[model samples]
Each structure stands twice: as C-alpha cells, then as structure tokens.
Target: SPTTANLLLPRLATDRAAMAASASAPPHSLLLAAVALAALASVAAARDENGVYDPCSDTRIQRGDGFSFGIAFATLGAFYSGGSVQLSPCDRRLSLASSGQLAVFRPKVDEISLLTINTTTGFNPATAGGYMVAFAGRKYAARSVPTFVSNSSYTVSSFTLVLEFNKGRLQNLHWKKDGCGACAKSSSLVCIGKQTCAFRTQSCKSQGPVDCSIGIQLAFSGTDKHESVLNSWYEVSNLRQYSLYGLYSNLKDTLSGQFNKFF
Candidate 1:
C-alpha cells in the first residue's frame, strides 16, 4: 500500500512544479484539473485493502484553498487587536424553561443580541437587547478589567465577558437582550475602572494604561435562575493544532449565513 501510494506522488509533484514555473499566469483549466486530480489521488490513497475508501478517513488530504475564517477585521489600535474570539460548542441550544438561558457566538456575525424569557409569559424578543459587536482586549490588571462582582458570592458566583477597545481598555458584556440599555445608549457612559474591578484570571496584572472614550460593560448574575446552561467558548487556533476536519464537524450543520455577518 505504501508503494502504491508513493507511485501516485510523482504526478502531483510534477503538476506542482509546472504550476510554480507558470505562477505568473497559469491557465485556469490547468489549476482545476490539478485540484481534481489531487482530490482523486487522496481518495484513492485513503482506500483500504478491500478497495473501499473511508469517506471520513483521517489520511485524506483536502487543502483549505479558498476558505476564509478570519474575524476581528479591524484592531482597536496599533497594537494586536481585532479578530473574532472563538467559543467552545458553537451551537448551544436555547433554554425554554422559566429560568433557562443560552449564550452563543455566531461566527462571522457583526452584532451580539440577547433575548430574555419570562416564566409565566414565555420568550420576549422585543425586550431583548443587542450591541454593536466588539472583541475583548487582553486582560491586564484585575482592577483594569470592567466586570461586575457580586457582593454576595453565594447569591451569584461570578461571570464575565470582557471586550477590549483602543488604548488598553476593557469592558464586560453579559450577552443578554434586556437590561444594559442605558449603558449602550450613552455616549459618555460612566464605567468602573480600577476603582471597582475584578479579575477573571487569578494572577492579574496591568499591561499598561489604556483609555477608552466610549465602551460598554453589561453585568449579569450567574446565580439568577435559568432553565439550562450551554456556556462554551470557541478557539479558532485549535483547528490547526489538531486534525482539521473533525474540529468543526459538529458546527458545520448549525453554522449559519456568511461568517462575518451575523443576524
């Protein structure tokens, strides 16, 4: 089998060499033919002694030629910034119970919308809240992060979703529909900085002084009742470190619309 697979490599290598030689203006047809041949070769190589190919074989090679998964189009400042933060379990279901809620990040979406449910009346999208999208900046010092801390840890353990803006600034978002309207509407929304802040990381320290003329930080309590919880984060970097295909197998069906444009 190894010898058989090796025998097919010469043609692919020759095609690649030819393409590189004519990189300036290779014929489109040639490119398509090469791609098709490569796919066929991979399928053939991934077959077993029984001549049956494993459709989902890990040995198969599929180049991610034209795919674009980049988010965070723009950075807040000159430093490292702008790119979608990934979450685990991208397709979390909504809770229908009286005390149920779910948080999901739509890959390639622009806005973050939160919907609320009233136990007696049911779900209310009208009362739901939304925000212009943003990504959380690097966590500096614990005090520098903008998030709510429950005075009574017993009532609400603690939760945070911080987004960064220009000048090393940060804000916490709860990803909910209602509440937090005033903060989003205000041009000069007052926020608690070093005065009243908590760190998500245990060993939090200040990177530097970052100024944010306008930002949003919405607070919510985890202790509050919810029907079911599907809190997960997606890490885009994981795709490459591990096997590529299975990384997003679960999300392929549930993922919707253009990744950059979320409803």
Candidate 2:
C-alpha cells in the first residue's frame, strides 16, 4: 500500500545505507550507526502520528511559559442552533458556523493583561451577536464555552479567560466574570447588567477619553484531566487580577497617541 510504503521509507533508507557502510566500518562504528538509525526511526514514527501542525492538536507548553491560542468572535446566529453537542472550535467543520473574526493571543501564565484591536473605521458588534470562544489543544481540544461580548446595549471591554491544565497538558478553558468590579472605580467605565463593564457602542467615545477597542485579560486555573489538585501556574504567579485597568490605561494612552494613523 502507498500509505504503508511511505511510512516505511525512512527506515528502509536507513537500513540500506547502514548495510552499505558496514563493509568498511569497525564494530563500534556499526553499533553507533545502528543507534542513530533507531533514533531516526523513532522520530519518524512519532511524526507519523503527529502529522500536520494543527493549533487544536498542540499540547506542548513548558512549565512557567505562556501559551498561545485563537479566539473566534461571531454573532449568536453564527453558531449551530441545533441541539447537538457543540463542536470544538478547531474542528474544520466549524468553518460553516465560525466564518467570523479570529484573534490570536500569546499571554504569559497568570499575568493579568489587556489586548486591544483597533480598527480604521468604527467597530461595531451589534450586527453580530457579539460572542466569542477561546480554543486550543488537539487530542485534548479545549474551547471556552461561548461568552457574550457585545450587543446593541453595550460592548464589554474587559474580560478574563482562564486556562486549566493538568499533568502539563491543557485541559479546559473558561471565562471568569469580573461583575464589573474591576472597572467600578473608573468614571470612564459603564457597568452593564452588573455582569460586565462595557462601553456603550453608540456613545463609547463620548462617554470616555478612551478609544473604542475591545480588551481581554487572560489567566490560568484548575488542574488537567482527572486531577484533584489545581495547577500551580496561576497560584504561584501571584497575579494581581485587578491590575487590568492599569494595563488598559497604558494601552489606551499609547493607542491615543497614534490614533491619527489608525483612523
């Protein structure tokens, strides 16, 4: 079979090359070649299973290192309305339901941070249902349950997405609501339904000095599959979760300076 033959090519080539070299090589040289060949074969076998690079299948993240993944934003209508179980965001079949906007972020573990996406023209989420999902991992495909970001009433600017890991592998992702408390002190922020702080799309720029950009803060928690103990990445980092406003202020100042270029 073509598939079987393709899979065996690496081993076959190594065997043939080794046989040709054995005639001139000493015993130790032959032994070293055999070891090298075995290593190559093992690597090939591993790659055979790994196949192409799919962000959904990525499970390699070092302890103390930040992770990278994608976020898809769309209207409620963009998702399947059927009663069937929700599919992983990384599923190719999801293209039908997720032909919306995607934003990728690589955030350090346990760090409270903000990311802003500026548009040349005004940004509006009202046309869409203003929902988003964060997703990563393959064999352990993890997707945060859908979260509402905007509507005709308001657009959320601050959010926290927690990544859960167990045994060094990502297990799940979920949204942690701030109940608008993080933005309570700032006169510039508007609390929406007490679930989030948002900028009213109609008067976002008029209500505050800040630009109308979407911001998300990331964190990590929980343990991986079937684990009782929580992952230490979040706890050990001693994150100041409320620092999101400070970070947002810095980002806003920097963005304001270059507002002319964006517009």
Candidate 3:
C-alpha cells in the first residue's frame, strides 16, 4: 500500500480537508506526506515511465518555459548527522517531520519571480532552523548555506535565490544576501542589525505581505541544455543589486493580489 499512500501525499499537502485529516495520521504517513507535497509541486512539468513524476530525473528545461519546484525547510539535525550533510532531501535517510515545512514555487526560465511562503503562526528561523534545500528532479538539487532568518531584534523577510544551469541542467542553487543596504535606504523597510533587510510584522497586511511571509526573489542564471551562448538570459536582464528590492516588491504585490485565492 506504499504506492497508494504515496499517491495521497499531494492531496494531504494542498487540500485543506486532507491536511486536517493528516494532523492525526501516523508518523510514517506524515513523513511521506511531506515528501509528496514537496516533490509534487514541480513534478507536473515532467514524468517517468510509470506516468508518475519522479523528482530525480534529468529533464531539460527550455527557455521561456515555466516550471515548478520545492524548497524544504528543516533543522540542521534533520539534514546533517555524523558530521556530514545529506545532498538531496529525496534520500531515504532523510526524515522530514512535522517540524519541517515546504514551499513550492513556479517560475519561468530566464525571468525573476517573487515567491512567498505563508507561515500563519510565524516562523522563527533561530528555533525552526534556517537551513533550506532547493530541489526539482533528483539530479537537480542543492542545499543552501545556513541562512540566519531571524533574531530577537528582527526578522529578515526578503532574499534572492539564484538557480544556475549548465547545458540545460541545474548545476547549483545560491542564496545571496543584500547586507541590509536596500532596506536601510527604503523609507518603508527596516534594516536589521546591519545584516539584512526586514519587515515589521505590525506593518504587514493580515491577508498577505512581505513581513508576514517569507519572500524569495527567484532568478535563473547560466546556460541552458543547448549550450548556446547567443541567448544569455541572465546577462540580458542586467540585474543590479539596488534594483532587486524594487523588483521583488513589485512582483510580490502582483503575485499576492493575483493568486491569493490559491495560496
């Protein structure tokens, strides 16, 4: 019945009714549910022989095409043990428990999108663990360096995640911090401890806002599978550091307003 259970994972993650049921499910069922929800976010773009989408396959992504993927947030103990780190969240050795969470985002190739994750109860990176992993297919996965999400003084709300591809395959995922430069200058934002930009929870809207949700500015870099040099999307965009905040805010508002029904 493992296969049947796996088939139910996505529903448990996205469906409110199923989610309520899962609160009382067994531990193993919860683990599969977490993995299923994370993996299913992106699998709709590709599939294997069984007509099931395997997140481990090496699929080619074309320019201008949109694809979905997941980011898993867990404690250091869940991902690292014996003084070593797990490469992929898909590994059987990894245990994704209730303490862990997943955020799914669908972004177009060569374009930047603002991705948000709603944590109704509020997420304390210091306590919940600031580690995250970005994964698509099994072969296209990367763990981010531990990012300090919040401290007693402030909570950093915005970040930039760069997906680097080489020859049409994902090579690495990088998290770039702005060192609070943009936030310090913005009249609407605040700089936290001179380390990062933050949004005050009081200033955020109850429905959805950067302060209430984790916001990631997603962008793609590197060459596609074709290995062609003519169309370098990253280079064409010419993204500057200071410009990122404006772009992130604009996209965040547009997406939140347009897709609030689903999220």
Candidate 4:
C-alpha cells in the first residue's frame, strides 16, 4: 500500500501540476513544436520533457516499470534550451556536471544511471540526449554508462540516443569503447574526449573552411514489450561557426522536411 501510495501520490500531484502548467503553457502541438524547435529557440521550458503526458497535461506517461529517469543541465557551461519530450534511459548515477535537481523520477527505481553521456558524446543541452554533466573535474566528467537498461532485466535495454550528427566527420574520430547494442541489429558508437570531437571530425572532412553544428537531440530510456518514438524539430538560432551553421540548417531542413512529408 505504501509503495502504491507513493506512486499514486506523485501521479496525483503531477496531474494537478501538469493541469496548472498546461493551463498556463501553450497548446500541446505548440509545446511539442517548442520542444522540436529547441535546437533553434533561445528560450524554452525548464520542466522535464518526460514527466508529463507528452501531448499535453492530460496525457499521462505510463511509468512504474522500475526505471530511473531525470534531466540535467550543463552545470559548467552555457544556458540550456529546448521544450519537448525526448525520453532516454541510462545506467543510473550522476555527478556535478550532470547535476540538475532530480525533477522527474520514480522512487526506488533501480540502477538507471546518468554518467555515460560525456563518456561517448559531448554535452549540448540545446540538443536532446547527451548526458548533462553530473560530475566534472579539471580533467574528466562522468555520465550515464549502460548495463542497467540492457538485457539484464526483463531481457531488454533501450538506452537510445536517436540523434543526428555529421556522418562524414564522425567516422574520422576514434569513437570506440562504450556500451553499445550487443545485438546484431544494434550499431556501436563511442564518446570522444572534450575537444569537440565532432567538430574536429566535421571540419576536417570538409573541402573548404566551413563550420558545422549539431542541434537538439534526445537521450531517452524506457523498457517495455514495445517500442516508443520521440519526434524532434530543430530551428537553429546560433552556430559555433559557418560550417556549424550550414550543418545545423541542413540537418534541420532535411529532418523537418522528411518528418513533415510522412506525418
């Protein structure tokens, strides 16, 4: 009864808060658009995207699967952006760099971690899914390392970071040695060291002096007998370089076009 009470209470509270939040915030499609446009929008919401009913305050996310989840901002860097729900799962644990107050999580949920992000990828809060720095020192940062979300539990794992980056340049970096989909259908990827590995990779691959950028991505996690999808739209606001600008715009346009064409 206590366990059920604990779960139910949060749901009730969240339901009320979500109702209040929705009454104040924009409509669901616009909110979704805000989440999608985060790559480009300078201002966005601070609430966790995965906490409420994604479509609106009324749509409740089905939790209680014994999963741990939360969102973190770069404790050390620039402001965070975006306003949509991108659900990512991790092997639970967090550090200062990855530290944001735990906004949305199920209590006593097992080893869902928060460290592996920077280990395999860099931190870009505007994007959806890299591990926000929970801990950072002069040299290294910790992130959501996998194992918790894998086949060890119900015999499945989905520490899915379904994001897009420069394909041409990413291949150049030595991005190896991180948890990967152990199955044949899964692909392998590694996080680069903090030197903007994607930047180096993207820049070198280009013919002329150009800059490229990566936008709002979602790092999501959940476990079920079925699969879930998180759709993102990015509108570019600022870029690191001209090369970065072109890359962001191109990816945004193409992805937006493709998403609109089908849906």
Q: lDDT of all predictions, in order shown?
A: 0.19, 0.50, 0.50, 0.23
Tell me the RMSD of model 3 versus the true structure: 9.5
lDDT of 2 by residue, 20-100 (tens): 222211111111111110110101111112221234456544433445566666655454445356655556545433356
User: Which regions of candidate 4 fall more than 4 Å away from where they truly are?
Assistant: 1-60, 63-70, 75-197, 201-251, 254-263
lDDT of 4 by residue, 18-73 (tens): 22333422221110111122122222222333333311122222222221223333
Worst 10 residues of 4 by lDDT: 167-176
As for candidate 3, its clashing pairs are: 55-137, 55-138, 56-138, 167-225, 168-224, 168-225
Question: Candidate 3 lDDT, tens digit per residue, 58-167?
Answer: 45665655444556666666766454866555554566655665554445555545555544334445445556666655545555554656444445666677777777
Which segments of model 2 are wrong by more than 4 Å? 1-54, 64-66, 81-84, 96-98, 110-112, 119-123, 182-189, 205-210, 222-241, 256-263
RMSD vs true structure, all candidates: 23.5, 17.4, 9.5, 18.5
Model 1, C-alpha of 137: deviation from truth (Å) = 24
lDDT string for model 1 (25-107, tens) is 11111111111101101112222222111111111112111100101111122111232323211111211111212221211
Looking at candidate 2, the ten consecutive residues that score lowest on lDDT are: 34-43
Total backbone collisions for each predicted model:
24, 6, 6, 48
TM-score: the better of candidates 1 and 4? 4
C-alpha RMSD (angstroms) for model 2: 17.4
Report lDDT (Cα) of residue 37, candidate 2.
6
